[model samples]
Target: MVRAENLIVKAKCFIPIPPNPKNILSLKSTITSLMVDKGFEPENPTISGPTAGDAGVYYTFTACTTDPEGDNVRYQFDWGDGSVTTGWYASGTEVSLSHSWSSSGGYVVRVRARDVYGAWSGWSGLVVVIGEACPYVYAWNGSAYVLDNNVLVESEVSNGSDVEDFYKLEQAMAPYYAGDHFSVYSIMLGEFENEHSFIDMVRLYAVDHDSSVKIALTPDGQILTYSNPNPPVSAVDNYGYDWLSSLSEIDEIYYQGFPGDYLLLDFGSLDVSQAAKLVLRANLEWKKETCIHVQTLNETGEWEDAAILRTRNRWSTIIVDLADYLPNPEGTVKIRLYMTGVHKIDFVGLDTTVEQEYTITEATLFYAEHSESGKVTLKLLKSDDKYAELLPGEQIRLYFILPNKPADKNRSFIIQIEGHYYAIQ
Candidate 1:
């Protein structure tokens, strides 16, 4: 229980030794309106700051509070690592403190505030973790977000979690038997980060069926690659029955075809606007003299031609950039594929690509499609010298940069891991 004059009595001894009578009177007056005398504690101080960092490296933590009675205030800190603050700090005007943990683990940071009368506020708390790794934190350094590291290691991910990160063919894949096509609007990798990191390799993975693949990457940073892929239906829109064809799938490949007969390839939503670049990709199969045509919807919602099949008699593929065709450049868009003749289409796919920025010394691009039958486990080296295992369908992406120069637009390769083969065009 506190009374106005009671504060004056409690505060008397704490006043400067042999305090001047006038000074003591002034202190008594101020105590009358102090936050503690009003029966209120300083609003519990708040802690807001990064939750992770590397040991022995300075990490800034923010502490904030307000005194209801508007008294001048100061703050005290408990670093949670057995470190003590020098003393109470002037906090009515501003507040923040920097600390470095001595070891790796989690810590609970506690802070509190005190009014001019020396009335202590309730403890405010925050939790932070320290790591033994070099890349300690990811944050903005005023002008840009920086990944703290001596040698930057880039990273990227896509597990068909969203079409914006990675796009695929129309939810329905029944039109032609061998050679069909689709397009994807991809964004520049740097857009996701504050800046761009060099690209090293492009990896692809698929399920069910494999054939010839061809790709063309245009200098415009538009991805033009080809492969015979039927991505999992799990990547389809989380909602909607608007499939590529009005007719139901008959065999996942065969469809009735005729002149002017068309099956739409829905790019759906690329989920990006104003992308600095595009990744136009597809999968197709063709026989001699048989052809298919592809088109994209523009910002104006108009369908326009994007590409034409050139499979000579044997099956061929084109996994390349369609620089001339930008789908839903202003928002989300879908592509349409028209059958120019009665031909059996084999495999067709569309994927979007974006570049990335690095934060560590090095990063390994990893991917696994979501499915009902099984799961894929991804592993990464952790700060504790142990491998960290990631559950299936968690993160799907590859982050890397070419060693000497920029990744060649004309570059191509094939990678195989865990009984799966990836043809990068």
Candidate 2:
């Protein structure tokens, strides 16, 4: 019986067979296709901001690429500052990385991608400049005036409108940085009664050629921060003199009163190293005394009248001739405005001209081919009169955003101007 059972089991068993040739070929073909060393080249990467910046700043770069075999990928970056990032990430998705240069220079940022199969794509690159940032901010030599006279007053101002009030106020600035232009200001004279009503005369001190420039914005710093809140408000708040508070009591500041009262305004300190000109403004319909006194602190600390305004009221914009007073290339100086001789204290405006930033859109630059093997000649393109209007010693920090190439620190570039020779610092 056991022998019979064994024979039956053997009958049921059969030999195992090999796989079919077509099936084996199909499997092999799939494996071979995956092994192929192919990866899609990454699209050109992009930077977050302008291609130029100051050192110690970080820049973000992004990239997106695909793989022919749909394999996961990793990115490698050469940040041009001896720094690199070799990190793996998903393919066909956007990836961003940030890097900062340690020193000021021109750098080539290069990037490439690799797949899980170890196939690498070609490199993409960008050039960035790391150095000084250009500024074209408002540069002015003007100061505003609002009076609060409660006591007797003594000023370099010649005539007194009314002598009973002590005054306090602020000096603001206004200036245009273009070709030499003129501005006007006026005071409303009642029936032409006070024929000599004028704004103050402002004189600028000379600036040093190598001194730093001072920047004054619209309503730079007013005196209200150190004084009272709930300041006097009148019916004529729209004529310009208006201060509400700066959020929590830091808003604007203005002045008001009939003729015979005066206000003294202090404009703090300003660096006038590159002052070009000045102007003052006011809004008036009628005037009694009609005078604005502008004075500057001399090197000896004595206040001297630098400008006076004589006008017929309406809307006035007056030029403060700084030809003799400016080019003050030294330290900061103080300015003051004495306002009197009007029924309502509306607003006063001051404008001063200072060195401005070099702009390619507003101006242009010209360069000559490499003079020798490594040197080039540069000049301001003054055909449009934008750069030609700039005076000597007008400092500008330039930024160059272009493809980075090998540069030698020993090589120097020359900048030529029509009226003066410049020494590179």
Q: How accurate is candidate 1 locally (lDDT)?
A: 0.39
Q: State the displacement of the C-alpha of residue 416, model 1, in Å, after optimal TM-score superposition.
A: 31
RMSD of 2: 24.4
Model 2, global lDDT: 0.36
TM-score for all models, in order of appearance: 0.26, 0.26
Q: Candidate 2 residues 41-62, lDDT tens each?
A: 3333333333556667787887
For model 1, state the Cα shift of residue 97 in Å: 1.4
* Whole-model lDDT per candidate: 0.39, 0.36
Off by over 4 Å in 1: 4-38, 83-91, 132-425
Position 16, candidate 1: lDDT: 43
Worst 10 residues of 1 by lDDT: 183-192
